[model samples]
Target: MLIKECKGFELEKEKSNTSEDFFNRSEVTFIENGEEKTLHVLYVRYFDEILQEFTPYSQDPILADQGLDVTFKDIVALVCLLKNPGLRGRKRLYINSKHDFAAYFQDIDFSKLPEVFQSLKQKNSYELRSPLEFILQPK
Candidate 1:
């Protein structure tokens, strides 16, 4: 059962050693129950592969201070919640009105974020991952 398909995405590579420049441009394909879709996502180094990406902005100090670890998966979850307001159920994850979606990260806990971004080197890899990618990816 496929959930989503990322047909295309853009990447902006950097010239520094920072992981921020790793994923310059990339695309993904999502398929679900015979249905297919395309979404734009930023790719970056993950585990042992360089084809993993996620979204929802990790550089935001709010996420860092909240101890919420940001990752590709988390970004997907956020996008899911955004697309489907019903999923919120009783959770206070979404804001009623806000143009800057990243602002929500301020309430999250960076320390509580996924373990995938615990290391410094991996942090660089995190940079490659784009927040917009998660928005397009299915939950």
Candidate 2:
């Protein structure tokens, strides 16, 4: 019954986090209610515009679920990125699976995304390396 805003949350991607035990053991620090708290955010959800709802691919979002990885920031970003043309149009970016690319695309610059994705276009059944793959990939 409590909803609060996260002031900001930044992951230092360049540095490998030894604490990250894959997704199951990852955690992030964020600001909420004027105080800092670390939450275990791990669930994946996609925005369903047709149904006008949020579809959770994981367990239900409840405080009792200590292992749940879902977070408001992640859900918001996924919805925002899916709304952009860069991730959806002709110069589309194909994610082999959710594990390949998740909600991180929303944090990147949308204006430059379309251009970067152009390099990813496949040729003769072999996909080319994209500058975006390095950029958008989650650490």
Candidate 3:
């Protein structure tokens, strides 16, 4: 769906890229079940200045289709987890797409973490890592 139809997220411009055509960007947002939401997200690339015609220019509209992609910083930690799990911070892959949510149910046992979507604010006993723990937690 077009961002204009969605309820969350704002259009922004990238100031660092001095080039006129490439300066537009937006802080990534996600849509779940046709609605927008997030939880404890610390996305930092949002533009302070709004780009009048840029259309959330950081990511092309297609990204909104595949859902939010794994970020650079997130990728770094993911790879590190494979090499060394001891140093990585408490990581959670919050589900922001339909595919992720479906994939979650297909791969995991219902008894381990039973909620279809659990917000981060709710404290739970599943914080312990299993070499690498990935949850389909939601916003």
Candidate 4:
């Protein structure tokens, strides 16, 4: 379904805040089947310890200098892979599920994703946003 068509959703307060008060917000909407669902699309703050557990090999200067942090978008992509066991890769970012993608990012327009990003089939082993298409849909 097109994101523009999905409307009239509200954010649930209890699940809105994360560890760092980053406000992990999402829109709760009722699907055509009358099933209520949530579309969490926000950034999650990560500390050094959490980064160490996920990406011990991260040599990014920003991560080392800032004590390592990741956005909620990063976590969502990771969860997508974890939720789907049949997907194969060396732990990288890529689009695997249309349903999850739509549910998580209702504001993005996937049709305009760049060819390069959309073609990215490999997933990153670390916790990070997938290709541009997976995060921002070229607005």
Question: Which candidate should be chosen as best, given lDDT against the real structure?
Answer: 1
Which tens-of-lDDT digit does each residue in 22-116 have in candidate 2?
A: 22212323333455433333322232121122232333221123333333333332233333424321222323235334444334433432232
Per-candidate clash tally = 29, 4, 1, 8
The residue-level lDDT of candidate 4 at 11 comes to 26
Per-residue lDDT tens digits for candidate 3, residues 49-131, read 32112222343221222233322222212222322433223333333343432332332222322221121113321132352
Model 4 Cα lDDT, one tens digit per residue, 1-139: 1111111112245554533353233221212233333343333333222333333234322122222333323334323332332222233333334444434344333333322122221221122233333444343
Query: Any residue pairs clashing in model 3, and if so which?
Result: 25-58
Candidate 1 regions exceeding 4 Å error are: 4-10, 13-28, 41-82, 85-139
- Best candidate (score: TM-score): 1
Better of 3 and 4 by lDDT: 4
Against the correct fold, how does model 2 do in TM-score? 0.20
lDDT of 1 by residue, 39-112 (tens): 33333323113112123343422134235433343343334333443433332232223233333333333332
Instruction: State the displacement of the C-alpha of residue 106, model 1, in Å, after optimal TM-score superposition.
Output: 11
Q: Using TM-score as the measure, what is the rank order of every candidate, best first?
A: 1, 4, 3, 2
RMSD (Å) of each candidate, 1 decimal: 13.9, 18.4, 15.0, 14.4
Error of 2 at 35 (Å): 2.5
Full-model lDDT, candidate 4: 0.30
